[model samples]
Structures are given as structure tokens and as C-alpha cells.
Target: MYGVFPYNNVMATTVSRTSQKTARIDIRLTSEQRELIERAAALTGSTLTQWTAQQLMEAAQRDIETRARLALESEAFDAFQAALEEPLPDEAQQLLARSPQWA
Candidate 1:
């Protein structure tokens, strides 16, 4: 008597050794949203699979950029209205505050 395994050979698979990179993710979407994706994929002359892959890649890139933090020089930052209202150290003075040991 053999008991069934939850996952088969496919579930234990790892990334391919080829140059192409790939990832797998799980998602749940409303029927309406699913239909929208199918329609867009048809319009673009791509199979639903290819279209979904491209869209997810683009979305991941946008999310990465939007969530990243940015830094700017003091004078450049000072030109903003909020910076004008708040007192800030001079750009040159900021360099002096660093730990000498860091060098």
C-alpha cells in the first residue's frame, strides 16, 4: 500500500541551469481582473501565458522603483519649499560631521 505524496517530482524541482532566469509566484485575482488580462493578451497577439509573464515583470520593475529611497545634496534639497521652512546644516558642514574613522 502506497500513500500519496502531497508534491510530486515537479514540486521538488529547482531553478534551471540555463542562462535564462525565471521565477514562480502564486496569485489570486477576481474573475473580472482575470478576464481583463485574457482580453489584453488576445489583443497583443500573445498567448495568455506570455502576456501574463510580461505584465508581471513590468509590474515588479515599477514596484521596485516606487518603493526605493532617494538622497539629494543639501543645496539641491534646500530649494524645495519644505526645506526652506526648516533650518538645515550647510552642505559643506555635513561632510565634517562624518566619523574620521570611517575613512
Candidate 2:
């Protein structure tokens, strides 16, 4: 029955320090997964809840920062700047001139 589901890693995050916890999450895992999580918790001297929260936050922040900026080589950046510096094409400028102006 246990072999029927897929297990990635130990990610137990429900057991917090306080009894008045506001949220709960239920998940299934194999013995190997459980042991791995416990070992990680022990190494960090943090409970399951703390370790999961910290790791989740770190990953999310990293993802956000990665997306916020484009990584380009120096040559690519120079080309991009050059493109911006160039004027719009003659047809595009003519079309803009014909469009109605707003007050």
C-alpha cells in the first residue's frame, strides 16, 4: 500500500512549538523520508516546523530575486543599451504624428 504513492523528501511542518497553532498540513511519506527530515532537524538544532519555514522562505526569496533581474553578459548589455539609444523607425514616427493628441 505504501509503495503506491510517490515520496520526494521529508517535509513535515505541522508540529510547532505552541499548541495554539493556526494552521495544519497533512502529508504522507515513507520511512526513509521521515528519517531524512529528522536528521536535518537535528543538524540545525531546530524543530520540524522551524526548519521547513526557514527553508521555504529562503527558496521563495531566491526565486523572487532571480526573476527580478536579467543576467546578461557585458556585450549583451552594451547591445541592449545601443538599441534603446537608437531613434524609432521613420514609419513609426510618421504613424505617431498622425495619431490624435490628448489634452
Candidate 3:
């Protein structure tokens, strides 16, 4: 039953102390997943906690690279700047001119 889940053992315990830093966080996971990490850790000669950290770090890096880029090309950037530079709300100014002001 335990053999049903798949894992990438190559990334299991390959930690780099030189370029890495530590942070403490609190999270919750299912017992089955926890058990799986424990088993993987044992098989890979790593602590369950360390394996989880490595997986998190790799996932975070991937997510940041994929989601966090300011990704406009040069033509789009120029167009966006031009749009911002253009005048705004001439109709709003006309409406304000027409509206009655109470003294």
C-alpha cells in the first residue's frame, strides 16, 4: 500500500549549506503524507524535517521564477508608459463643471 506513492529521491537530501539559510515555520499536513516523508527520509538517510525543507525550498524557487517576474517586453513597456502619460478624465472635469456647488 505504501509503495503506491512516487517520489524523487535524487532531490531528497542534497542540501547546500554554503548558499542556504534557515527559517522556522509552522504548518499542518496529513498523517499519510507525514508518514511518507518519514519513510523517504529513512530510505535516503535524512531526517524527515530536512527532506520536507528541501522540497519546500525547491518548490519556492520554482514558484518565484514562474510567477514573480515583471514580464513586459520593451514594446509593451513603452505602450504602458505612453498610456500613463496621456491626459485623464476630461469628461469628469466637465461633469464637475456642470454640477451645482452648495455654499
Candidate 4:
């Protein structure tokens, strides 16, 4: 497993690495930024690399999950459902009847 560490006295888990293959990513940061990150890593009892990777992975997962979901209030959902059930306008129906140009 890569980038696993103890945070707040609790162990963090990650997927097991099945092979020795690895890749590297590099970034430049100001000294102030580095210090802040180093301080956070120290508090979590993780090395800078482990802490940075863990945070990046968690943030990436959160972003992906957010993008994958849709939420609507009950009234809004009902309106959306009604719109889908409504028949297409004559112009739209005529368009649908034609063979697609791309096809």
C-alpha cells in the first residue's frame, strides 16, 4: 500500500499496490506554503509525501463524487418529471421523423 499513514491517532487505509510500478508528480510551492503543509503533515504523523498524496486522493474522490450526483427538491423533481412526460411540439416531432444527417 502506498501513502498509508496514521491521522489523528487513527490508521488510514488505502488500496494495496499489486506491482512495484510507480509514477511521480512534482510541484513548486513557496516556502510559506511548504511550511504550512509540513506542519499539517507533522500533526498527522505522516511524512510530507504521504500526507500530500493522501490529501490529493481524498480531494479527487470528493470532486468526482460531487460531479457524479444530481439533487433536486421535491417540487423541482415533479416539474422535471412532468416535462419529460409531455409530448414533443409538432416542429420537434417533425425533426425527429427525419433521418439523422450524421447517420
lDDT of 1 by residue, 23-70 (tens): 667689999998999999999999988899899889999988888857
Give per-residue CA lDDT, model 3, range 1-103, as digits (tens).
Answer: 3453334443443544344666678778899987988999889888977888888889999999999988899999999999998876899678877858763
Q: Count the backbone clashes (under 3 Å) in each candidate.
A: 0, 0, 0, 0
lDDT of 2 by residue, 12-55 (tens): 22233334568766778899987898789889999987887788
Best by TM-score: 4
lDDT of 1 at 57: 88
Indicate whether candidate 1 or candidate 4 has the larger lDDT: 4
- For lDDT, the strongest prediction is 4
> What's the CA RMSD for each of the models?
11.5, 14.9, 15.6, 9.0
Q: What clash count does candidate 2 reach? A: 0
TM-score of 4: 0.64
Q: What's the CA error at residue 17 for candidate 1, in Å?
A: 6.9
| Model 4: residues with Cα > 4 Å off, grouped in runs | 1-23
Which regions in candidate 3 have their CA more than 4 angstroms from the true location?
1-22, 70-103
What TM value does model 1 have? Answer: 0.45
* Candidates 3 and 4 compared by TM-score, better number: 4
- Clash pairs detected, candidate 3: none
